[model samples]
Structures are given as structure tokens and as C-alpha cells.
Target: MADELKRRLVHASGSGLVALYLLADYLAIGLTWQYFRYLMIVLSVGVIVLEILRLRVGLEWWLYEKLTREYEQDQFAGYGYYMLSMTAVVLVFRPEIALPAMLMLALGDPISGAVSDDSLKRVKGPKVLVTMFVVSAALAAPFLSHAPLAILAAALGATVADGVTIRIREFVVDDNLTIPIYAAVLAWLVLEFVPI
Candidate 1:
């Protein structure tokens, strides 16, 4: 019970990272996309460097052990992938698609993780999928109401990407990276084909 509570707390705490996406989107509204892109690049690079140093120096082991998966210790942590993928999604997609996709990733993924018991399961259960969709739709509705199909597709893609863990050899692709990218791609496709 104690371990379960600890896991829940740790998972829930990841929702705080959503602030980074919100701040970036707010800045993108006021500043140029190029400015936001450059800022994200710099921040991602800094995080990568810090992570490398942390691994080398064995710094913050307790935090990493608590927050990261066993496979992540030898590779970049999820936070590094989060920053890198956020930057990539912003650079690859337009503001309309990118913002909502990032928002779904930032908020929905953590909610799903916190609520679901996927420790023994590989795929998300119906409860997890429903929670993820509802949360993502609620958060995305205001911004994406005009593009309902696109938003729904993006939300579903984000939730699925978050629920599945993809491994490529020694590296595990964190959902922090997959969720936004998948959501953005699906949303873009919907906008392109559906005439929305």
C-alpha cells in the first residue's frame, strides 16, 4: 500500500511539467515561433548536458531511481526526452496542432499514468483509455472546438502512445516523446484530409 501510494504521488507530480508546455505556448503567442523554437532548443540541450553529467557523476541517484524506469538509468531519462520531444513537436507542427498536442501530452499522459494500474499490463485498460480521452478532450475543447475531428484523433493518439512502452534495442522510447509527436501527426493528418 505504501509503495502504491508513493508511485501515485510520483506519477501525479509529473503533471507539474505541464507548466513548461503552458509557458512555452504563452510565449509563442506573444513572441515569434522562431523565438520559442530557439528557447526550447537551448533548454533541451542544457537538460541533455545535465543528464549526461548526472549519469557520469552518479548525482541525484535517489531521485532518478524513484522517477525513472530501470532501462533509463544508462540512457537519457524521461525528462530529457520530454524536453527534446516538446522541442521537436513545436518545430515540426504548426501552432494550431502543436499547442493542443503538447497540452494533451502534458496533462493527459500524467493523469492516465496516475490513475491506471498498468504495472502488470502491457496495454491500457478501458478505464485508462476513457480517463485519458475525457481529460484530453476537456482540456483541448476550448482551443480545438473548431477542429473536432482533429482534436479527437490527437487525443486518442496521445493516450495510446502514453499507454504503450516502445523499446528499440537498448533504448526505451518514453511516452513523453511519443505522445506529442503522435498526437501532432494524427491531428495534422485530420486537418489535411478532413477539410477542417
Candidate 2:
């Protein structure tokens, strides 16, 4: 029962934060306190760094290990940090469409990796990418009718960005630097041509 509780908490917190971010964004509450969100992001990163140090010192486990572990300790810590980081960016930057898409990437990717059990269970390459495209589209849909297209583009962009960064950082770089940047660029493009 303890294990069951842990699993439920991990899943709940992991998915819950993303859902909250979406809710806040759709309700337009995030934009009102955007700076607070960035502050939260900064705080979240500091926490991750501190935790990383703790894990290194044997007081706790590394964030990535916790994220990938079957147990909840690592996931709870990792997810808590992720939620803060994501909420921070969404609030500060107003990356409405990209907010959910990126969270989907952050939350969903690790979950997928964990759930894809067995050495023989190979997720098809294109199918996996396509699945992400669909998922991204669905998540981004409420923001606008063109949200799916934006998400598809972002997913591909994210894939390429992930490939480029895989060996670069020993710890997670701010998605403020990654996913939000993509969202910013997309938002910029969307805003660029409108008659002012």
C-alpha cells in the first residue's frame, strides 16, 4: 500500500503541475504575475542544483536517477522542481501555446522512457515522433486553432534541440533557455506581421 501510494503521488504530482500550468494559462492568471513565475523558475533551478549537490554528497539521489527510478523519492523531487521551473516560464514569459507543449515534453518524455519497459520493447522511431506530434498538437489546441501546427513544429524543433544538447549539459539547462526560447521565437513570428 505504501508503494501504491508513492506511485500515485508521483503520477499525480508529475501530471498535476502541468495541468495547473495549463489551467492558469488558459484562465490568464499566469500573465498577471509573470515575474513571480520567473522568480519561481530561478528558485526551482537553485533547488535542483542544491539537490544535485546533496545527491552527490550521498544525502539524496541525483535528479535524473530519481526521475527514472521506479520509486517515488527521485520522481517526487524531480517533478516538484520541474513543476516550478515550468510554472515560472509560463508565468513570466506568457508562452501560451508553447507552455503546455514544453511541459508535455518535460513530463511526458521521462514517463514514456520509464514505461517503455523490457529490452525488446522498442517504440518505433517515426511512430514515436509522430505520437509526440499528435500529443503536442492536442495539448496546444486550446490556445488557438493553429495550435496543433505550432505544436508539431515545436515538437520537431524540440527533437532537434534535444539531439544537439544531449551530450552538452551534465545537468538540465533551463528550459527557459531551451523550450521557452522556441516558444518565444514562434510567438515572435506570430506577432511579427500583425499590423501595429
Candidate 3:
């Protein structure tokens, strides 16, 4: 159990580092990339402070542990897929999209997972799907280009990705590796096909 906890902390920290980079880029872009040098200085200092706090107070492990605990197996699979997908799409085109989308993917899904679990107590299937769809659509709308379509597709993709991974994890390989790669590929294909 201790080892598992330690492992989860390391994993969460890796995700957090990625998120930090993405967030810094997002802030810089939102600020039109001007004064990025100053922004970087401020953010770097902040990160160092946070890192010191984490070491001195165990803040990093505590937060990661809580996040890992709140996440169900299905939620973990879903989140893993979401990150991998967003990473790939952003790597190819519209790198700007990555910072916002990946940040949301990292933060939003977990929040929704916890909230939806309680809100829908005993509910299952398409009902849960619709709830996530609506929430994701609303959250994603203001951030993406084709707001409605992108949100709907992403929500649906998340739904299917979670449901399938939950059902198949026992009989097959980990969905964490498969789902995100597929999603990224799908996003890439869409980008290629779209007129843009």
C-alpha cells in the first residue's frame, strides 16, 4: 500500500509538471506572448516555492494521494486517455489548443467525476453519459473553435472510452494505453480531413 501510494504520487507529479508547462504557455499566449520573460520569471519562482512547500510539508504527496483516491478505476482510465489524446492533438496542429484543452482534461474531468458520482447516485449508462456530455460541452464551449461540435464529440469520446475501458480491463490490456492513442489518432484524422 505504501509503495502504491508512492507510485501514484510520482505519476501525479509527472502529470502536474506537464500541466505546469501547458498552463504557463496558455497564460503567455492569452497575454499575446508579450512579457513572457517576466511571466516566466514569476511562474518559475512560484513553482520553486511550491516545490519547496511540497518537500517541507508533503503537500505534493497529499494532494496526489487525494486525487488518486477520488478516482475510480474507470475514471483513471478515462483521464489517462484524455491526457494522451490532448497531448497528441496539440503536438500536431493548433499547439495553442493544447494548453487549454490539456489543462481542462487534467482538472475538469476529475471534478466532474466526483460531482457526477454523487449527483447521479444509482444512475448508470446513458443517463450518466448525457450528464457528462452536457457538463463537458458547457466547459469546453468557450475554449474550442467549433465549440458545439468539438464539445459533443469529446464528451461522447470520453463516455465511450470510460465505459469500454471499465468493461474490458479484466479481459484485455490496460485501456490507459490504448484509448488515448486512439483518441489522438482520431483527432489527427479529423484535423487532416477538415477544411481548416
Candidate 4:
């Protein structure tokens, strides 16, 4: 439980990545969209290299043993998937869309995880799902308020990503990778299709 708590705390820190945009812009630190794009590119590439080293070279980090689940020891860890998904979200969506999606990942996932029982194979309980939806909707509302339907869609998308586990042969899809992308894509779709 202590280790799981540590993992969730680290997961919540992802909100700091989204904070880079707000703090930089307001502080006039000159983190322009193009620079952010470049940063994401660098981060994604770096994670790819690190993952290769970890998976292929038998490289082991101390944190890996403490934070990673037994299932993750034989495959890519969640943090690698996390950064890659954030990179994709930052690069593909506008700030209004991207920031909220990132929040869903940074905030919603960890919050839901705190309430979850990892022993379950699938379908988190209603309490966990409700918490995810409420937190996700609240996080997205400030950014997506211009379109109410889009907020619900974004929240629902994030909830589904966090609450369900999909296994593909040997791979289990990580919510770290799916939450932001799914939320962003769904919100984008609603915004694009249903005129406000």
C-alpha cells in the first residue's frame, strides 16, 4: 500500500507538466507553443531511448523495483507510456483541449487509482467510476465550458479509459497512455462536430 501510494503521488505530479504552460505563459518565461512542441518531441524521443535501454539492455533503476507492478517488470513501465501520451496530446491538440486532457491523466487517473482495488481484473466499482467522472468533468470544465456537451464527452472518455482494462495478447493498455488521448480526441470530436 505504501508503494502504491508512492506511485499515485508520482502519477499526480504529471499535472506539473501541464502547469508548464500556465506558469511559463503568465510568468513570461517565453514557453511558446512551438517551443512546447519541440519540448514534447525531445521528451518522447528521450523516453523511447530510455525504454529501449530498460527493456532490451536489462537496465534497472532503483525506482523501478519500488514503483512498478509485477506485470510491468517484464514490459514497458507506465511512466514511459505516460510521457509518450502527454507528448502526443500536447503536439496534437490546442491548449484548451490538450490541457484538460492532460489534467484527466494527471489528476483523474491518480484520484481514481487511490480509490481502486488493484486485485480486480476489470470494471472498477461504481464509486471509483463516479469519482473519476466527477473529478474529470471538474478539471475539464474550466477549459471546455464553452461547450457543455464536450465536457461530458471528455469526462466520459477519461472515465472509460481509467476504469477499464484492455489486454491485447501480452500487452495491457495503460490508462496513463489512454486517458489524455481518449479525452482529447473525444472532446475534439464533440467540439468539431456540434457547433456551439
Give the TM-score (vs. native) of candidate 2.
Answer: 0.55
Q: Return the clash pairs for model 1, or none.
A: none
Q: Where does candidate 4 have its weakest 10-residue lDDT segment?
A: 114-123
CA lDDT scores, all candidates in order: 0.74, 0.47, 0.44, 0.89
* Candidate 3: stretches off by over 4 Å: 1-93, 115-124, 146-148, 166-187, 194-196
Candidate 3 lDDT? 0.44
lDDT score at residue 125, model 1, on the 0-100 scale: 85
Q: What is the TM-score of each candidate against the true structure?
A: 0.79, 0.55, 0.45, 0.95
Model 4, 1-196: lDDT tens digits are 8898898898889898778877896888899877988988898899889878889998899988888888888788898889889889888999989999989988899898888876556778999999999999999999988899999999999999999888889677998899999999999999999888
Top of the candidates by lDDT: 4
lDDT per residue for candidate 3 within 1-196, as digits (tens), equals 4644454344344346344554765656443333333443454455556555544665555544444433432233323433445445444435333333443344334433444443322233665556545654454455555544554455455445433434344443333333333333434445556544
Candidate 1: residue 184 lDDT (0-100): 83
Better candidate number, 1 or 2, judged by TM-score: 1
Listed per candidate, the RMSD to the true structure in angstroms reads 3.6, 6.5, 9.2, 1.2
Off by over 4 Å in 4: none
Q: Residues 62-98, candidate 1, lDDT per residue (tens digit)? A: 6666667666777777778777877888889877777
Candidate structures ordered by TM-score, highest first: 4, 1, 2, 3
User: Candidate 2: lDDT of 37?
Assistant: 58
70-166 per-residue lDDT for model 2 (tens digits) = 5433433544444554554465455564465445555444433343332322232544445544554555556545544555555554433322333
